[model samples]
Target: EAEVAQSPRYKITEKSQAVAFWCDPISGHATLYWYRQILGQGPELLVQFQDESVVDDSQLPKDRFSAERLKGVDSTLKIQPAELGDSAMYLCASSHRDRGPMNTEAFFGQGTRLTVV
Candidate 1:
């Protein structure tokens, strides 16, 4: 079975440090998304990419966060000067929306849990 891949499942950093997370979506997926989930809140969409181009990033804080999918396959999300309030679980998901009806489901990775102190 195919699955989304994420590295460094856990991360710890002091406030004001930089941190990055990586994700590799399932092969052939055309849409990739990054989300942030606080301990008790539902996940919030941070960015969305379609074939190396950004489709939506209105919710992302551009001043401190950035994301990229260089080759339209794998992606990276980075947070500069991480803050205490930035602690959360970062999730990556992918879907082949252009495929036929049955292939509409999105697959999610295990997620990277970040702790900022």
Candidate 2:
């Protein structure tokens, strides 16, 4: 079996700097999402893409965060001028929506942990 997602896994950067992470999702998954997990909370949806089209990003900080899944393959998430509050685990997940409820398990990445110094 192939790995569902691949990324650098860790990142540490100074405040006000820019950082980016990438995730390579499962081959046939059409719904992709980027989630941020804080210290003791469950992952929060930052952005969601349905085949290269953004479905929702209401929680994403548009001023400093951006996400894209152009071409509907791999995806990227970027943060500029990162703040201390931005330190968290960024998890990428993808699921093939065509599959029915029972089989539509979301495959997740081993997340990129970001620490803003």
Candidate 3:
């Protein structure tokens, strides 16, 4: 099966530095999601997009984080002024459909682990 693509499996940076991650969802997928997983906690949706349109981003920290899905396919997430608390696993997920909570598998990437010191 074709898989979602993510870059820089690991990232190490100093506080206040800038960091970015990239992801490419599976072909034909209509919905893409970015999540942040802290330690043992479940992932929290940072942003969600449906064919280049923002579906929900209430939890996204707009001050320092920004994301875009140009062309409605590949997406990128960037963080400026990184904080120590920002250290966590950044995951990218994609689904074929988002209209219903039906039984559909959400494919996740290996995730980009960011470490801020």
Candidate 4:
């Protein structure tokens, strides 16, 4: 995955606190996604948006994790009362959805590494 733009390269927080990560996708792309990857594991989809409308968020832990792509430009992922298991790389990616499902290339960002103690 080619890296896009992400903020706060790293974060360290204690359990039960809130943490947030931001991502700016490639210009003109209409599809955005958020993923979490544990150490030594591939990224797992958490949320997906197509022009600010949520298309899929089945994998998202809605109880504590929330994602949004407002205005179809940038996106944000927030975790409230983070647990120790929440520590992982939060990746942001975008693709041209018009290319058809699973047919477009997705570019990822240098994920935010969240550490919950």
Most lDDT-accurate candidate: 1
User: What is the alpha-carbon lDDT of model 2 when measured against the actual structure?
Assistant: 0.91
Model 2 segments beyond 4 Å from truth? 98-100
Tens digits of per-residue lDDT, candidate 2, 1-117, equal 756675778999999999999999889789898999998999999999999999999999999999999899899999998999999999999988765556877788999999999
- Tens digits of lDDT, candidate 4, 1-117: 445799889999999999999999998889998999999999999999999999999999999999888799899999998999999999999988775556788889989999999
| TM-score of each prediction | 0.95, 0.94, 0.95, 0.93
Query: Per-residue lDDT tens digits of candidate 3, residues 36-86?
Result: 999999999999999899899999999999999989999999999999999
Off by over 4 Å in 1: 99-103
| Residue 32, model 3, lDDT | 96
TM-score of 2: 0.94
Per-candidate RMSD vs. true structure? 1.2, 1.2, 1.3, 2.2
Clashing pairs in 2: none
Which candidate's TM-score is highest? 1
State the C-alpha lDDT per candidate.
0.95, 0.91, 0.94, 0.92
Residue 27, candidate 1: alpha-carbon lDDT: 98
Cα lDDT of model 1 by residue, 35-100, tens digit = 999998998999999989999999999999999999999999999989999999999999986766
Better of 2 and 4 by lDDT: 4
